[model samples]
Target: MTVVYKLNVFKDPEQLNQNVFAAQYAVRGPLAVRAEELRAQLKEKPDSLPFTEIINANIGNPHQMGQIPLTFIRQVLALCQYPALIENAEITQKLFPSDAIARAKELLEETGGIGAYSSSQGVPLVRRDVARFIEERDGFPSDPNHIFLTTGATQAVRMMINLLIARPYHGILLPIPQYPLYTASMALYGGRTVPYYLNEETNWSVSVEELQRAYDAGTAEGTEIRAVVFINPGNPTGSCLNEKAIEDILGFAKRNGVIVIADEVYQANVYDLPFVSFKKVLSRLQTENPNDAWDKVSLISIHSVSKGQLGECGQRGGYMEVTNIPEAAFKQIYKLASIDVCPPVAGQFIVDILVRPPKLGDPSHDLYHKQIKDVHEQLFKQCRQLHSALSSMKYVKCQEPRGAMYLHPRIFFPKKLIETAKAQGAEPDELYCMELLESTGICILPGSGFGQKENEFHIRTTFLAQGEEYLKHYVAGHNKIMEKYE
Candidate 1:
């Protein structure tokens, strides 16, 4: 009496799209999954592991660890979520700050309330704010039409990849140990990934020679290199690109007719070096060489609220600023955005505040300034502590973190450890990270996940986890693993 379903749909991995199956995102790949399993187990059995809690140093997530949200941002978001709060004078006066109420009212009026869907491109007023912000930062004019508000920098990256990769043989040049998102998107869009290794000894700096080599190699292999992705204040390496380096990259793109996709999400996270936007540099070049072909360069620069001092990862707000994009191509990008209807209404609201926070005379100025300064100082302090700790470990060479929230240190594993990893069909760094996680509950990503040179071993750990006590635990766990191998 029972009907049998014939060949259950998508039951087998093979039933799914081959491209999806081939794509591997190592940041949240296996170790993160295992950490979650351990977390669940700890809830059931407190004594099941050596540590009481799982320390997630695997990703650059600030709030999940303990970073507090900015007071002004949350206040405005609260009012936006419930407009009735604005009508209640008692609640508004007691609970909300005057600046928060004013901002919420303005944004609510502009977007017609957070419940409604914004324009496919984004709220017009928000785009204007973004344009003004760009003008202030780069000292160059920006058009509201060229800006596309996105769920996050991740979505913008996917759209850019989709736009550039018209054929299966088209390739994108990505830095080795690059953010996995770039590689993952290229995979998803059926594009080739050509890797250009950063010079690790020189603070993981980019080399023009390496870029040319990568490009030439790809061309030799009959792959048309269409775009180059640069993650400034890089994700795993924590290195910031100087103005000169950015200029060189733009010149390369100009000469090769390749599209430049600059990921500047960590613009505010720079420590030792000043942050420079590719757009700013590009503008300078275009202005200087009025007769040259600088205007022919197509560039897409992206920024986000996730990694900056704002630390609004869950908000999922970001924007892509396009320059020299053809009118036809711009229409295609717009069409793609239209397919998604619009980004999150709340996210668009956050983007507005991100680009245009309180001014010097505003009511929330002092508190806002103090909160942002504290976040910056704390991040810098933690970066130094972790870098110092890792630098002292045996056979480990750690780079001083210049920007971003991670320290990717190279670990020289012993032959025995390598053999053990080979026996288990894993990379040496993967084995080390797994054992460290099992023994100490400190989850970090292996360098293999981010792509390293042959015979080189490394691990990427975020310094976002608070306190020196966990740092001591990490050092002890790491040394124990090394001693066992030795």
Candidate 2:
């Protein structure tokens, strides 16, 4: 008699954690994956698609879209990675600048080496530097103890969500059409997402009334609203919140006894308006209303090296500054970080460079400043050009994004197109985007992936890709689809 073997338990999707399976990240979701497949096919066949190459307008990855890395950052990182280079003084001195070498030596002593594990919080010196940077930016004192160097802002947000969502019914107020990371994290941690819609017609402004209404609805349903997330110079919407908006949000959080998680990774990407930090606004409130317990309002402000002029997405450097969190809670948060052992040491090195860059008259100063300026001007120019193209399309309406790398445009699908999408069990925007990718070899995300009002459609695309030729193809393909649907 032959023995029979059981199949692997994890072979069945049901056997795994459903939360992991249920979470959706549309930025690198199905459409982006398909784009990769098409890219491979084109590599082999060379004539597989109508267009010659795939233009990845899907995600805000600048370097992948042809952004040049800054010289100082790379040079310092190189020295740190291999101290042998520094030891070979004459050769290294000629190749690397004096300051970069000195900076690398300083960081190497603090970090031990790139391969070693840093403090679970981060390297003490780097954390202190980050604190100093925050103090200067916000005009408020920052505690190094409260600063946690993360893999990126993504990890920082995840840590906060994990700490706050203690129960299944605990909830967080998230903006509709948010960066999917927020929603995905909430789902992973098993919490309710109370969505507050932004006013798209009014430049995607935040209304305090909507926040109150969402909070009330969640509370009514027995959800303990733990925190509210604000993405200034927002991800998909690209709307920058004014000082008044920041003040109103802080007041709402203070009154409701909820935490404020501000995602300000795009702080350096502002074009139309000045980028203001939540920490600054909160400090001002505390100073003005000394007796009003503004100190009780807790906040976690996050920033990253991935989105700015640095564009070091692969390097994975970021920090979170926590204010007014209780001692007990802060300790628990530290423990959570310790469990991960530490973030990437190389990433920590990047964070150090990010906070303290070359100054005036430094050997690398002029080149670094010029590169930064060029990137900023190029990105702003690209944003304006893309916005004009989308606005000129037949049924597309786009708001000029104030900051951030992406643009979200509302698309009016014809009745027939909507009915066709329904028949296919897909959102109209999703269907349109898929067709667009196949025809144009240009990948962009659908608005449905980022949440939208009922019966309306939109799409999110990054203006990171360079050149005008691909844009012409995009416009032509878009109008062709509209004409066909009409």
Candidate 3:
């Protein structure tokens, strides 16, 4: 008998794809592509590219979007790239401290070169520097060994999530309007997402009651509630957590017997109140609870160079600090990271720079201070302008950004809006965002893909677009959309 074969193009559309991950990862629709094509086209005719401006609202890349890297950072980073930079008179303009210079030279001498692969965990001296940075940040001692540098916080998150999955039934709990990195990692790893609602009415905070309700519901179903993830100075919604809220969450995790996951990439970017860490809460809770309950809660905090004053998105450097972890779990988590060999060596340098900035009296102090001040001020103003602009929209209700760079406002749209979008064969927010894309060349992430409530709608856009022109254009474009919503 003769057998006949059919091509995949002839198969059922869904059947042609393998793995649920390939589909879940597909959640980010076409914005990235459109942004790239626009840039490529602009590169072809540098002068005639309408308005000398093509804003990339897709990712938070400050440098690519015209936010210059800190002088000290780029100076040191340049040295790392081409060691000849050290001897170059023009480049050595007090960007490195005596200690920092000694440290970098020692690192280069020890490693022979930046091109060499670091230890699976990262360079020892670099990890030690990170631990020091954390200790200073939280006012608690940090162990160097617990630090695992990854390509960025993204890899570290995946590793932490890998350790949490107790099979399909168990889940990781996160705020609904979370960074999609959380959802994407969970879906790709065969884990479930347990979403709790963020109080948009209260500037996207975590209420103790909300935490209890979600945890109780999940555990009541015998769902292996593995971890609770919170983005301090949140991602899409830029509200910083209050002290009581942090204490309540620490207590909640302590009582519920779940891991506490913190994404503190924007830790240094707080505007109003001082930024607090779960480690700070954990330390405080230890004084009262005394049972070491908070310590025993199995915690991992993720940090990135991609946010705050560093905002090194292209560097893609981040570290996950594993604290009070069980020995077996720690080994397993590190082993998962080892499978990737190690994060990029150059990125490891970025982590070192973040953790070990110039202290007082160092050679680079004056310049470092000036550089940090200027860049940080620019970011602060941008956040203010964007927040003010969005708050002016009658149909957009946004919280004032306390930290980070995005505003996620719930947009008022008609009941038939989603249905109308379905008629167009698209997600409602996606349809809304795409119209914004096609008409004005503005790009942003719709809230639906980032895990918003069932009937709610919103969009996330960064404030890094240069000059008044793009932001003014953004605000005006949204006004047109809001008129439709009205």
Q: On residues 277-305, what C-alpha lDDT tens digit does candidate 1 reach at each position? A: 99999999999999889999999999988
**lDDT tens per residue, model 3, 343-385:** 8877888788788877788777777778778877888888788
- Whole-model Cα lDDT of every candidate shown, in order: 0.92, 0.92, 0.78
Off by over 4 Å in 1: 1-4
Error of 1 at 85 (Å): 0.6
Report how far residue 70 has shifted in candidate 3, in Å: 1.7
Worst 10 residues of 3 by lDDT: 18-27
What TM-score fits each model?
0.98, 0.98, 0.90
Clashing pairs in model 2? none
Cand. 1 Cα-lDDT: 0.92
How would you order the candidates by lDDT, starting with the best?
2, 1, 3
Q: Is candidate 2 or candidate 3 better by lDDT?
A: 2
- Could you give candidate 2's per-residue lDDT for residues 351-406 as a string of tens digits? 88889889898999999889999999999999999999998898999987999999
For candidate 1, give the lDDT of residue 254: 88
